[model samples]
Target: MPTTRLSKVFPEELSEDTIHIIVQRPPRDLEFMPKNKRIRITEGWKPYKASNGKSVDLPPSWIGFLESAELEPDPRKAFDYLKNDLQAGDAINIPSMGQVPKDFGIHDQNHKVFVTEQMLELWEDMRGDKD
Candidate 1:
């Protein structure tokens, strides 16, 4: 009679397949706020002068779109929105807030803004699993 080793059965597999099986996590809970309901930050810019001493263009604003529907201007509120409000494919618009060039259309689509590793680590941390 031959005895089979448990190592032969498992072999302590450590591949992508094993990792995928071990790290199965639930889908992220997403919340979307209406575009008009969110707060928009109008950043300030400097004025430019031409050789004729005439102001060439107005300063541009760095628009920070917040996820809160309440239109709050606080940084912490903005951070909260960044963390909880928006998802991967959200759309953003500049809406000609400040001195941005008229030809520049700021309406853009959001890509994978939040990295997967961060979310994965967060999920693992929440589960109290350290691997």
Candidate 2:
């Protein structure tokens, strides 16, 4: 079965300033505790940002969050945030957000980014849902 993959997604409607990156809390792995007994750090995507400036740190599984984004002031700080306070910052969710495709075709270097009609529609509704 051929599944749709999106390497990078930049909804045409959302400008560069929108905080669209969705990050979840880092998981805890402990030898003392069984995998099932281990605490679930986060159940859903946390309203996290990579930098205070708009983007957020995401794992390789979610690396395809953004297709093309201009870097903010400091690149180093953003990396540190990933290590330290990824989900520690914002703890809210932007409604109207749907999961972007995760299977970003690892075999291909030229990552193909697909912005579907549904994605656009989902993003378009974000503003209305914002409290």
Model 1 clashes, total count: 1
| RMSD, candidate 2, Å | 24.6
Stretches of model 1 off by over 4 angstroms after superposition = 1-74, 83-107, 110-114, 119-131
CA lDDT of each candidate?
0.41, 0.41
**In model 1, which range of ten residues has the least summed lDDT?**
59-68
What lDDT tens digits, residue by residue, belong to model 1 across residues 1-131? 22344344456854543323223355542324444333221233445655477764333422222222344434443333334444345543323222444445444532223335566457456756557
Per residue, candidate 2 scores C-alpha lDDT tens digits across 28-63 of 546556654443332233344554567554443244
Model 1 scores a TM of: 0.17
How do all models score by TM-score?
Answer: 0.17, 0.22
- Clashing pairs in model 2, backbone N/Cα/C closer than 3 A: 49-56, 50-55, 50-56
